[model samples]
Target: MLRGQAKGMATLFGQMLPAESSQGAEKAVQWAEVAGRLQSIWTEFQVEQLSKASGEKSHYTDPVKWIATFEAVMRQLPLSNPQVQQGLWDEVIAVLTAVLGQYGMGPRAFEEAKGDPHMPLRDRRFADPEWRSKPIFAVLHQLYLLLSTQVMKHAEAIEDLEPGRKAQLIFAAKTIVDALSPANFPLTNPVALAKANETGGESLIRGFEHMLDDLRKGQLTHTNPAAFKLGENIAVTPGKVVHETDLFQIIQYTPTTDKVLATPLVIFPPWINRFYILDLNAKKSFVRWAVEQGLTVFMVSWKSADASMADLLWDDYIQAQIDAIDHVRERLKVPAVHTIGYCVAGTTLAATLAVLARKGEADKVASATFFTAQVDFEGAGDLKVFVDDQQIETIGQLSPEGYVDGRYLAATFNILRGNDLIWNYVEKNYLKGEEYPAFDLLHWNGDVTNLPARWHRDYLRDLYRDNRLVVADSLSACGVPIDLHRITTPAYVQAGREDHIAPPSSVWKFTHYLSGPQTFLLAGSGHIAGVVNPPSSGKYQYWTNDESPDTLEEFVAGAKEHPGSWWPHWVEWIRALGSDEVSARGKRRPGGRGDKVIEDAPGRYVMTR
Candidate 1:
């Protein structure tokens, strides 16, 4: 009871505080045409093929027969919802056309469903038990039957009534018929699926199923933003309101306090997501691993922005990096330090390196490493396809205050794996009445954060949209010119072959674009798995090629033997720079302007998530 009262008070206090401004120098549109062309083309091609193979005159011409065929298939397959069922029917219908397109649709139209546009929706119906057990293909044919008949009737009605009312009446009829329709497959208990409809439809029901699964699997969280929150530790404290930028800094670790290393390694992670992803937890944390290896590691953890920070642009982040570097150098009494970055954060690092190099301060940056980070995005795989004008518009409209909600960003990721995360949640939480896991990673993932909208918007536009990094016209943190070729820092790039998000092909382009003594290592795992990988358990492998112009093709050519877990290899490479002699203690204060020590391994940020 006491805790609850305190929690409520804390919540109330937090609500009263003002938030940082969102990114405002950008648009708000979300691109819908991303990674959708494949399915779209496939749909068109399949229809033509099916028609040709079925010996039908044309697929669209014989809507009844196709509907019948779909119904037959639905009876055989267990489809989850009407949306899935509808999509299935659409595919089968395309197949019919593809197979039977040799005959002309104009002349060989189905007699029963002639000119009927609304027939399908008006007549479709199915029983719950039987529908759930039905085969996918059988349901398709059944839907085809219902849809064809309705379409035919709608066409007939169109000739008698006015065009506007006729369309409305048809839509109303379709809606009614759709209301009675069961999912192509019967969902035993929706699992995470919705208990009550928000709008309506089988799509919603199926979504519930997916939601359930995601919740149970630790993909989604039910709580508020905690992932990037700071705690009461000097090493994890936000810089005293006096420093340049208030980014939380980590200066010291207790585990390796006895053997302080010479090199200071600070990691700059993307503000697109929370920083804990890199330092997730002990045993699974890369940051923790490095700290154990005796490297003086410091990390910049972004705080969720509020309404007052809308004008913060990408340049602000680069300056933050520079300020962080300056702060760390001042505190550690070191002339320069090693820096590592992941994904978009790496892009910022590259810009920082360029900025520092142009002024002849390149030597201050001892070494640099990019983990699956893309600088040259000429062929940035399909991920870039989504960064269109509309998406920018969406970004503009939604982030009016210039802050991009981390939950919204996470939502986009979940969209890519909708069946596993989003739908699974609906299935479990709302349908099956199951619970989410107590795992830290999932809990952290649920801990939301937001970016200053202007910064994120500029980032997407300049980097993803304009491909500024690839073109070498990237603006520096201080509005000065940047040259990618100026990057002479010893660099190591770690990436995964099967990374759907950052394809090796796209990531390796950094070598071609940047002039640095670089080694590109390709790991054999998906994006998340490859990074968090432990040794000897999985078949993780890597290959490297220090070739020129670092294209995917060039790297593939020089590839040779497979190396085991890359973590050890990285330690060896960086170890060569360290001295075996006893190192001196840090003379300067930390970036946070304090010299206090932290108790926790992952510190406050990890705990926040």
Candidate 2:
């Protein structure tokens, strides 16, 4: 019997066989169809949509656009160089023939099985000899299936997808090849045929495969899980105690008047992703540098959401962060504190500052920092497409109850880079008999968490869909306008250069609209690595300037040169803004100098949603 997902694929092959090979094609159709459906559905629903939806903007590939893209891909593909393209085509035809021939079938066998019960009713996989293996359905279905498995197994970057919806994406190649009319592609040109054949095969296997690989190695997942292993002064350094919480967390690095005076340090990390990216394994963490430099650092550790805590929203984050700032002031009694925001948290922090500025509380915000945060949604990139009214409505419908299911967020991340996260694992671990390395980062990626649906829905609509923060619209929770110009605070914006989710173009916008003493630093590496960067990593590279440039573009042009760690620079900047005072230290709880401080590294309050 054929696998449930492979029915359509079996039929397509059945149509490829000749009358004489009908029996053979019939025998294989059932099996192949199962594989086909899995791939097709995966692409249609998951890969395409999620990628299109990752940003505030959406980009689509129409049939003509796809054909052009294929031609372009063909133009640049290494396969075209010195017969590599022809070589790939030969390998492709061989693989298809062998896979189908195992059941007494050939390309013609599928044609012969058209009338049979199991085989697809089509004449062949494609009308073209080059595309004789399978139709759009079979090819995409397989691609998606492979991509799905790759992301599921290898991805450590995604924190935005759901399980059930993971099965709905499709990556269709029909439009890409269908545009090759004999006029554009001559049958005589082995190069053209080879290009088509090579591209089709490579794209099916590699695009999704590469996508999965990207996600697996990416930090979104790796950062969360690996930290649990370090018990004490772990080798990796950024783990600094910021605030000793009620749960007995050492709070890493405690703030001191001396620490706050010298540098502008505000730690902002995504609520979905952990805050420790800035404080990951000791040697690589920024928190460690702040402690050494006598600069106080305040990092926000957002708890993972669960069924019990789904009512949290953007406002909750804004308020919690403000409370944290207040707590810092009361303890250390500093007049103001520097703020840093990352990913969504970065956007939230920016909004918080804006709100403060608008409400005449700007004095409380001495400075602000944004780490890969998004403000404007107008051209925010591919993230917008997924939230088309339909998905937004769907998610909103589910949000009234509180938390957005973590599975759903996981699915989104998986879909964003389906090829890497899904197909790569399928090939490497399942088919290739390869073993994944036992990397701590990989372990961290496996750690999944959930978001409240209501909060997420509001976020998508207000921040992304509406562009309320950047556009200066009325986004008041309890009667407060978020004005950027009102913010006279010294500002610094840092971003991960290779961040696909939050690109440089979008992040640079922070310097454009906000009226403040601002500096933008393009950090080295992807999102998480960029933020968690420690000086030990061969000295991190950053694009920054403090010349007081007028615009983001100019700032990038006149940025200063620095080879050492950015942590010291950040620490110095923050410390310069404060005064040296022992009174800033956390009070002796009830006992004496030997009194117990936070009992753990990251406290329980930080872990709770």
- Minimum summed lDDT over a 10-residue window in model 2 is located at 163-172
lDDT of each: 0.56, 0.53
Residue 484 deviation, candidate 1, in Å?
A: 0.9
Displacement of the residue 605 alpha carbon in candidate 2, Å: 4.7
RMSD of each: 19.2, 14.1
How would you encode candidate 2's per-residue C-alpha lDDT over 220-264 as one tens digit per residue? 232223345543333234333445432112243554233234323
State residue 271's C-alpha deviation in candidate 1, in Å.
Answer: 0.9
What TM-score does structure 2 among the candidates reach? 0.60
Task: List candidate 2 stretches off by more than 4 Å.
Answer: 1-266, 396-401, 545-565, 579-598, 605-609
lDDT of 1 by residue, 1-609 (tens): 111222232233234334442321111110112113223433554575565534323222355754664454333333545775687678567645532342233333432223343122222232222222223423444555555454435433445555433433443344333322332212322211123212222233333434334433334644222333334211232222213234444434333445656777878877666676665444566766776676777777665676767777766777888878887777666787889888888888988888888888888788888887888765665456446676667776666566765666776665455445554444344333344544555555566667777777777778777887655555666777877788888888888888877888888777775676677788888677677665544457777665554367767777764756777777777777654423434342232334444443334443332
Sequence-dependent TM-score of model 1: 0.62
Judged by lDDT, which candidate is best?
A: 1
Q: Which regions of candidate 1 deviate over 4 angstroms? A: 1-244, 255-257, 536-539, 546-550, 561-564, 578-581, 584-609
TM-score, one value per model: 0.62, 0.60
